[model samples]
Target: MGRGVSGATVVMSRNKFIIYIGILGLLIAAGYGVWSTLEVGGELVLSGVVEADDIHVGSKIGGRVLKVAAKEGQGVKAGDILVLLEPYELNASLAESRASLKQAEAKLAELVAGYRKEEIDQAKADWLAGKVQHENAERFRRRMGDLIERELISHQDYDDAKAKAEEAEQRMKSAKERHDLLLAGTRHEEVSQARASVEMARARVEILKTQLDETVIRAPVDAVVEVLDLEPGDLVGAGKPVATLLRTNDLWVRAYLPEKRLGYVQPGLKVKIRVDSFPQKNFSGTVRRVNRQAEFTPRNVQTTEERVLQVFQTEVVIEDPDRLLRPGMNADVFIPKTSS
Candidate 1:
């Protein structure tokens, strides 16, 4: 009797366990059905691809590539150095500019300060010497004239004496002019010209400095380097893109909506996004804009002939707080139909 009772109790316990498992399975199935409905039932889904603005980074002033700091598919922050150009030429130019600026500034300073005392003194000395030479030459020429009149000196000797006197007078005049100019000091026009030259030289130096800074290619926004085909020895031209970066911080979606849907869609409309990679997750976004004009579908539509007709381009700005989304990912946008 006791053995039978124990066997009965065991059988009863197994039955209860099976019943509990069946009830749990039914509950799970019911919950999954509800979830599927919630995921699939509501909203008009529009398909698009994740897109971000591609930033082309290059040097404003070109040179041979000196260093490539980042590579393809590498994430980078704003202001990060992506590449460096050979600064030897720019550095040399900057040095030359500095020298030129210094020379011009020195000239300006000299003009502003006027002739030094030592220079004036030397001019005075030169004038005195020239005067003495001129007086002596004049005396000799007069003597030679008297000799020639008496037929004591040859015609050639009198001519030579006259030439020497005239040369001495010209030299004396030049020296006197120099002395007077020193005493007169720098003229306002001369100082103005020197100052202008200094300003021009300084401006050139600043321009070269800015060009030197351009040799370093920096990221303007947080991005991923999508293309970097340059190495250390590669020569790149000015204003030519060396690397292509996909801006990750500011991402949006580009979708094509049928012309008929234009009435229901407008900017600032709330939308949900779903990517194939994360089907269970939904991202928030807002309609940024809708194209005014319509264009034919880019490619043959797989769904229906109607979808292949004219469509308006739409931009949706995705809100990716955790930065979980990336460019080129195919996405489904769920835009709520507003009562038109």
Candidate 2:
């Protein structure tokens, strides 16, 4: 009977130990669940890739590449020469335009100045000679008319004299008009037309000069050259990209957050960013923007559940001015939930 009692006691002790272990396991699991829920609700982490302003540098006009002043991964400042296009054709066109402009200008100046001293003197002399010829013709016609009336000359002879007199009179009138025109400088309409021509030629010259300047490609902003597609002899068409430049100052990370976490993120919120390249360094950034619409989870999403959940795109701008971060670098962003 005592053996039976000891055996029952051992069975009871084993049962109690098993019960205790079960309770401990339940408590640990419950604690882990609460901690995980709190962590998810209080903070959010998103993965993204770094991005910068990509500027495609190209020519406004087509030409062969003459020289490349920059190379891939080169940092350049605003107004720095990035490439040079063959300016041979442009220069030649410019020279021709300048010559035409000079000619137009000289013509306009001459018109404005009217007739010269020698020209005016010659005109006056021609007018006097025409007047003398007209007077002599008039006298000869009068003599012919008197002779015809007395039957000393035929009707045909008198008609010829009269015709000569009329011609001389017309010549005199033309000479007098020519002299008057020379003394009148230039007419307002003529001067205006000449000035218009000069202006047109001037505009052509200015346009060609501008095109020539465009042959020397310059960086529009301070950036790093990300691509150099042309060499010394490559033919680049008009508006063709010669290089791609990334603005170092405009760096950001393109990240997406779960739709449910939208309320916890907003523009101007402070965040921390980390990159695999610089494991020890954490960069500071501010939420620059958050997309209004929700979309399917991106292909790079880590969790299967996240793939089905709608996500909003978020742009976090890096505050680093030294350009320690580069585009396409995978980054992790951590944002703290703000108390509403």
Candidate 3:
């Protein structure tokens, strides 16, 4: 009877242990199910890097660098001078152009003003001199005519006097024409030509002015200098990059989303961006754009659904990117799903 009771008690203990184990397993399974459901229905997060556009600033004209006002990673505002090129040659050219323009403008003014007082006086004096000579020649020609009629002078003498009078008359006429031209000032065609010359000179000066301004390279946008390729006394070529500036104000997170999740993503959607550099802070962003076409799957997408052969690129522009975010820094973008 004692053996029987001991065996029964042992069997009963084994049954209770099995029941407790089964109940615990069921509870554990139910908890796993709830966790998986939450994971599936939670907000989607994407991994990407902070990126921005880079601008290469340089001079339009090539010359030796005179000064580098900015260093690598220096912040600069738009229109700030980042580099200065030697302006000796360009300045000389500009001065020459300005002188030429001044001369042209003066000529135009002179043409518009007509003749000067001294020039008109000289022209009038020549005309009066020609008139006096013509009058004297006419008197001599009349005397020769009278002598020829009385046979006191030869026909050859009369002809000589006539030729002299005709020559004097022609001289007077030419002098009168010159005086009229002087009084009339410059001709229309001459004035037009002068104006054209002035315009051409003005255009040349403007071009030189632009070139001279280009000698001082300024930042095109608010950015941080990412590269400084030249120092003082270094030669730089035209259109060659002297410095590269990253546009910090236009910062965005470039992330890839699974092709299947593209249907829910739209422009102007709010998102939260996080970076390993600043674990405690979260940056707010907006969905600026989504790629219309699918591309090859990116490595960042790890979900089974995202493991498909295609993914879509998306850009989330940060609202206010301070020093917290940097280009090429790995970032995570979390986008909450909308209720169906």
Top candidate when judged by TM-score against the true structure: 3
Best by lDDT: 1
RMSD of each: 12.0, 8.3, 8.9
| Cα-lDDT of candidate 3 | 0.84
Q: Candidate 1, after superposition: displacement of residue 119 in Å?
A: 3.8
Expressed as tens digits, the lDDT of each residue in 1-340 for candidate 2 is 9999999999999999999999878645433221111234556777788999889988888788889999899999999999998899878988898899899999889989887989888888999999999999999999999999999999999999999999999999999999998888889998899899999999998998888887899999989999996779988888888889999888999887766677888898988888889989999989999999776544566876554466677899998866788888888787887632
- The C-alpha stretches of model 2 lying farther than 4 A from their native spots are 1-43, 143-154, 187-193, 267-284, 297-308, 329-336
Cα lDDT tens digits for candidate 1, 1-340: 9999999999999999999999878645433221211224546667778999988989888899889999999999999999998888879989999999999999989988889999999999999999999999999999999999999989999999999999999999999999999989999999999999999999999999899899899999899999999888999998999999998988998887766667767898888888888899999999999999767556555776545355677899999999999998888888766524
- Range of the 10 consecutive residues with the lowest summed lDDT in candidate 3: 30-39
Scanning candidate 2 in windows of ten residues, the lowest lDDT window is: 30-39
Please give the lDDT score for candidate 2: 0.84
Model 1: CA > 4 A from native: 1-42, 120-184, 297-308
For model 3, what is the error of residue 235's alpha carbon versus the real structure, in angstroms, after optimal superposition? 1.1
In model 2, the clashing pairs are: none
Q: What is the C-alpha local distance difference test score of each model?
A: 0.85, 0.84, 0.84
User: lDDT tens digits, residues 160-271, model 3?
Assistant: 9999999999999999999999998899999999999999999998998898898899999999999997779999998888899999998998877666677667998888
